[model samples]
Target: MAIIPRLSTPQTSPDTGPARNNRRGMMWLAADLCFNIWALSIAKSLGVDLPPIQIVLVRALVGLAVLIPFVVWRGGMVRLANPKLQILRTMLSTIAMTGNFFAVAKLPFALFTTVNFTRPLLMMALAALILGERIRAKQWIAGGIGLIGVVIAVDPGSLGATSASGIGALFASVIAGTSAVIILRRMRNEDALTQMIWQTAGLSLTSVLPAIYFWQAPGDHWPILLSIGVLSQTAQFCFMRAHYWAEAGVIAPLGYFSLILSVTVGYFVFDEVPSIGLYLGAVLIIGAALMASHKGKRG
Candidate 1:
């Protein structure tokens, strides 16, 4: 709840306006990443006992509840420019969210976060295939490097059924998330709040039935579940504000720092020691993501 102060230190004011905003942005980005990992850690705690669908259901319901006051204050929802795309995006997001919860439950936190860094590489392939965007040789090289990193990290030969499924679910979630981003690109005119509202609403609606089927009462764990909701929403808010206030070049690299936080949590909280492969693979993946991000900014 009071994680901001712990995750990030206060930034001193800079002389220039842009410099100040960038510093603010970096701080927010740190908070965003830290908050997200905090939420995931909570989910991992719950995931051992509760079904992933049920966890997803609680998170969506709580997010929607949190947004209700804002929705009312903003004078109801804004008109959507692309309702169909919104529906499609919502469907994809539900898939992504559920998959992510499942992966969090099944995989080691460090591994879960490591594979997530490949989203940029996944997005690059999606952009080429779906958006008809041109992929440069460097982008291809980066993607290949990221892929190798994934293979090494995953270590197909060593995976058990549960870990393998977790990896599979994470990959599905990343692809679905990338597709959702592509849809977001198509609906640039839609209000961000409107999108957030619709997303929470849709995820709750779609997950309700499955969550019911697999439901385990939160019982004594309600507080932890509620915190997951609050942290996720806060993280989303910080994510948006960070990009709004800071240069992409400034914040994009900071996103990778989340892996460090995840690794810390895994080692201490879950006692998951990273193997040499994980560290080696993380290097390639982070390097590839940075290269891909720089190319996108230049393009």
Candidate 2:
């Protein structure tokens, strides 16, 4: 029922462009990717019996712990102007995170990364169908090309369909994109750190019950769990700051670099080599991201 104060937009000289900001965003994104790869590999390597929900909950707790000191030092819990919207966004985020963690355990690292980039495609669809936003023929064509990449990556006809983990990745991808939609619609004006912190809190809370129900103590991997928390919290902070410096679309394609890095990690850490389809899928996803960036944002 109440409206938050609107700040005047800053003006930038045309010559300045978004290069500097995009570069900064690139660093933040790369860091996020590294931590992400490390966490996923840790989870898989732990060889524990814990369910994905439990792993996610532990991750949330770790992120919250890392955030608490900063949230206190930087002026304590960021007040929400719209608590209801914030809560809604947090719920969607938890679901997305759950599916993602599950997928990380199920699919190969390179394949998981390939599917994740398809978020742009989902965003394009939501923009067109849900918001009734007008899309150009070029965007649609680009999206189609991206879809082709996804199919090639998953090759779902038989091999993919039967694998629960593979399906989890699909579930996670769509849910993650939906969460992006919620953020774009309602949380656009919120402080990035504040929203992230609160959403993470919500994530921890939402996951607690499920985590408890399926609880399995992360025996012998406590250090790895701690690392997951620290890495994810830092990554989220960097991710927030990155967007502050530039448009999300500008930094979106830089994600391809993460895929490349993930492939390297997959090979060395997981002993997994990318297949031809995986390489092909990466190309399509990157190309689609470039095309989509010309039009909009990442999922």
Candidate 3:
């Protein structure tokens, strides 16, 4: 249970200039990305034999339990705001989390992460449709290139690659992208803790029954599951705090380093060797995400 270190709490200073904020963001981003990637790999290993829903539900409950004490200490229920949006964002994000875990259990890590490259592209489209944001030509071009990468990596025509979990993860990424817009909107009114608390509570509530029905005894897997919960909670906090302290441009590029971590873990832990197509696709996707971020700034 003590396998993971406690994350340092981030403090925001109004007077901290861009240089300081950028450094802080990079540090937080690096820490959170590592924590999240590590947690996901562990979750996949432990949850492989167990029901995916059961594993995720336990993670949710553990996270909520962890947060309750902190939330109470930080003004309790009064900290929660914009109640309807919280529920909406929570459900959407949980759907994405559940889908990612479910997919991770079944798919190879490189392929799984490659398919996720579509998320930023999808977010652009979703923002245009949902948030009424306008898209630029560069975003469109980059997104098209990114889509090609995903198609190459996922290879929907392949019998083994396009399993139910693969398709499910693809669909979930789209939903997750859309949910992010709502979360961004809500961030203006809600603090990160409130959102984290509600998200855990919602995931636990929604997943409990399904988890129970599909439940297989985790047995010796409890410690890994607990660490998953702890790391994920910490990761979410770092993720939110990263954005809060710095601009999107500073944060976006640093995030792509996660690909390296995921690839390394996949090769060593699951013996998943990346194909040439997987590498190419990862390049396209990461490039597209970076371009999209730059495009947003230009607009």
Candidate 4:
């Protein structure tokens, strides 16, 4: 799943003051940060020689296993209504998942993450075009800065670096951004639990064909494969809860902390460190996200 900004009113208690809201918001940000870090780690681990479809299937199956209990506890299978939208969401999610897995498997974690970070910028543009939301000048500037960061991260000078995997990741970013825009626009109309259920169920069913055709036995990698699904579901659960407690503007910028987590993990786990150019690019991207968050709050 993609991390999108959730613009919601902070939950407040009858006795508590603004201090409570601040505390809850901070907790939400922490949760969001932790979720992304775990997600990136799982993605990196699963990148080892497995086909994207196989990884995704394992992820879907695990998500379904977790989701089944929740759905049953809530109201059983009948709770899954809106079959058509669920199908569409699932198809889009599958495409995004395939692109993301392929990119992670092929590119450096830092580079892949830098490219993925472009989602916020893409979200701004798509919000205007698809949702008819007005685009502010600040939003445009942030988007431009983010684009510069992407260019720097994906340096054309690097030999054999700009492969189809990189291109696919870029496409995935766009798809993910668009999905977020839609979710943000429709947040009021749908509950978070409902959205989560649809995504999990839809992707699980839709991906069956690709998973079947490209099916590789889990082999000795069952632990890793299971981890991917379980961690992903946990992240989604945390993200959904976070949204209920805090505003998207506050939580969204924290999502960039994933870069730091990825870089650290890449270094220790893979002994791969980001170049100075990559660091500079990361700063630019992060700055843009901060600016956008500030603008979003003001508006």
Colliding pairs, model 3: none
Q: Pick the candidate with the highest TM-score.
A: 1
Which residue pairs clash within candidate 1? none
What TM-score do all the candidates reach, one by one? Answer: 0.91, 0.83, 0.86, 0.84
Q: Which stretches in model 2 have alpha-carbon errors above 4 Å?
A: 1-24, 70-78, 158-164, 246-250, 295-299
User: Could you give candidate 2's per-residue lDDT for residues 1-299 as a string of tens digits?
Assistant: 00112122334678974344567667767776677677677766653356777877888887777667767777888798778877777677767776766667667788888888877777777777767778888888888999898888777764653355656655665666575564557567877567767877888898899889998766776777777777666665566556656677667666678788778888898898888987987799779868865844568
The list of candidate 1 runs beyond 4 A from truth reads 1-20, 296-299
Candidates in order have lDDT scores of 0.85, 0.71, 0.74, 0.70
Error of 3 at 112 (Å): 1.5
TM accuracy, model 3 = 0.86
Winner on TM-score (3 vs 4)? 3
Error of 2 at 153 (Å): 1.3
- Model number with the top lDDT: 1
The sequence of per-residue lDDT tens digits that candidate 4 reaches over residues 118-164 is 77767777778777989879878998998898778776667375455
3 or 4, greater by lDDT: 3
Note each model's CA RMSD in angstroms: 4.6, 5.5, 3.7, 4.2
The local lDDT score (0 to 100) that residue 117 gets in candidate 4 is 73
Better of 1 and 2 by TM-score: 1
Across residues 240-281, which tens digit of lDDT does each residue of candidate 1 receive?
778767888878888989889989999999989988898889
Candidate 4: pairs in clash:
6-248
